[model samples]
Target: MSGPGTAAGAAGRAGQSDALEHLARVGLIAYGMVHVLVAWLALQLAWGGGSSESADQSGALATLAESPVGKPLLWVLAVGLVALALWQAAEVVRWRSGWSASGDTRKKAVEKTVKAVAKAVVYAALAVLAFRAATGGGQSGSGQQQQTTAGVLGWPGGRWLVAAAGLVVIGVGAHHVLKGLKKGFLEEIDLASAPPTAERTVTRLGQVGYPAKGVAFAVVGALLVYAALTFDPARASGLDGAMRTILDAPFGRVLLTLVALGIAAFGAFCFVRARYPERT
Candidate 1:
């Protein structure tokens, strides 16, 4: 028999993946850039993306990136970034409406070209991320995505896009929470603290991180945007900033640190999931 959440989960997966894949399909270069945008938003919302003390504390992030540790990580990130501009442009041309309608031999040639090029792109992206992993860089977002943002969209424009994307991310996460709740996926994560069962596995897997921080990112994004709009940057918070603020008391700092660590873990999980997005 089919599980209760299966249909909902499948539909959700399709919705998310198709949208992302379509972005890549449109123009791989643009796809690379979009992932970079979302990843920065994730960093801000989930990893303490911005600061209250400074209007655009992303400079602090840049400063952090310059540290011996940060410098090496950037090196790793940069190496992985592929300028997919020319490559992706060719792909768009090859796959344009007529690509599929070509004769069988031509179609086979097109398919071969797509696969070969796509594999190279994937390899290039992975190489950059692997450097991050080698340098002991922490996972806040997929390092592959990090590579793109760090190198491609530099400075004021990049920051602006990232900040806007933060708001979009928050909205997306909130939407996920609402959909999960309506479909009863939220209940799937409930713990029994007893013997394992098929239901428990499915429920726990669905519930663990998706509902909570998915929504948390959204909240952080909204607040940060509001703060930016109100001209009160002090009100702005990312995952790190918000949690730290909430736990301002003595032991609170410790709690927030743990939360930050947890976000890093969640990001790592996503990176891993990207390697096997279809597995779950």
Candidate 2:
């Protein structure tokens, strides 16, 4: 009879499967494409006389939807993102099963577990969004965010909850900034076998990309906090709102242009990661 231990071992093996790894890589490519699209939308907002579409992931997917090959691409994205989520789920299982055997400090193990869980949730959510887009059921991400914020604010003590969530997002943004500045992302990828030029390109992309993304996230989080404080859900308009906020600042056009370029760099980095990921 197979026991819990046996089941865990099976899960671990399944997580390391070659097929899943390939799918996860494909998912990374799709992820990169989304970021590229977002960068394009951001540029439009910055200088192309403004865009009707939101400058966020949902907007990017929606752009894909308008293309002739949109449905097929969306289906591919949905499948790849689901696979990526499953791969992260498998990582969580592996971490749980080998928690004691890995000989790592308890803190490190916990951190790994948390990261895996977070990735799984993020990928799963993206997969759902892609699926919805493919099915013609996609909704505006900013609008959805506003509605959700409004609903949350209606609950007792929801203001505090929202504020706490904002703080968490800010922390995440700070981490990204630190990771970029400190080259901490190098620890996550293996480039020993990569050509010198390729390695340099990847490193440069990451250095520029992470901090830009961090800034964007920080703005979003700040907006969330502001919305909570003012009891205005409209302020919680997600990424697109964040971009617009930046555009409204002094010297906004230059800043937004730089940020858009950084985002494109990040998207390009994702393509390299798809080719040489140390972990799914």
Best by TM-score: 2
Weakest ten-residue segment in model 1 by summed lDDT: 52-61
Q: What is the C-alpha lDDT of each candidate?
A: 0.43, 0.87
Question: In candidate 1, which residue pairs get closer than 3 Å at backbone N, Cα or C atoms, i.e. clash?
Answer: 44-49, 48-240, 80-128, 170-218, 188-203
RMSD for all candidates, in order, please.
14.1, 1.8
Q: Could you give candidate 2's per-residue lDDT for residues 1-280 as a string of tens digits? A: 7765776687788877999989988898888888899999999999975667799989989989999999999999889999989988877776665566544665576677798898899899889989998998968889999999999999999998888888888898898899899988776566876778878888999999999989998999999999999999999999999898999999998898888898898889888888888762
- Residue-pair clashes per candidate, as listed? 5, 0
RMSD of 1: 14.1
Query: Taking the tens digit of each residue's C-alpha lDDT, what string does model 1 give over 1-280?
Result: 4542454354345434554444323333222322333334334443455632221123223434545676664443444334322333344344443344558866765764565465456545544443444455545432223454344235555556656866776776786566445544423122243235534444443444345445455656765565545544444445434444535546654544444443333333333333333211
Instruction: Compute each candidate's TM-score over C-alphas.
Output: 0.36, 0.95
Report model 1's TM-score to 2 decimal places: 0.36
Off by over 4 Å in 1: 1-73, 79-169, 176-206, 225-230, 248-258, 277-280
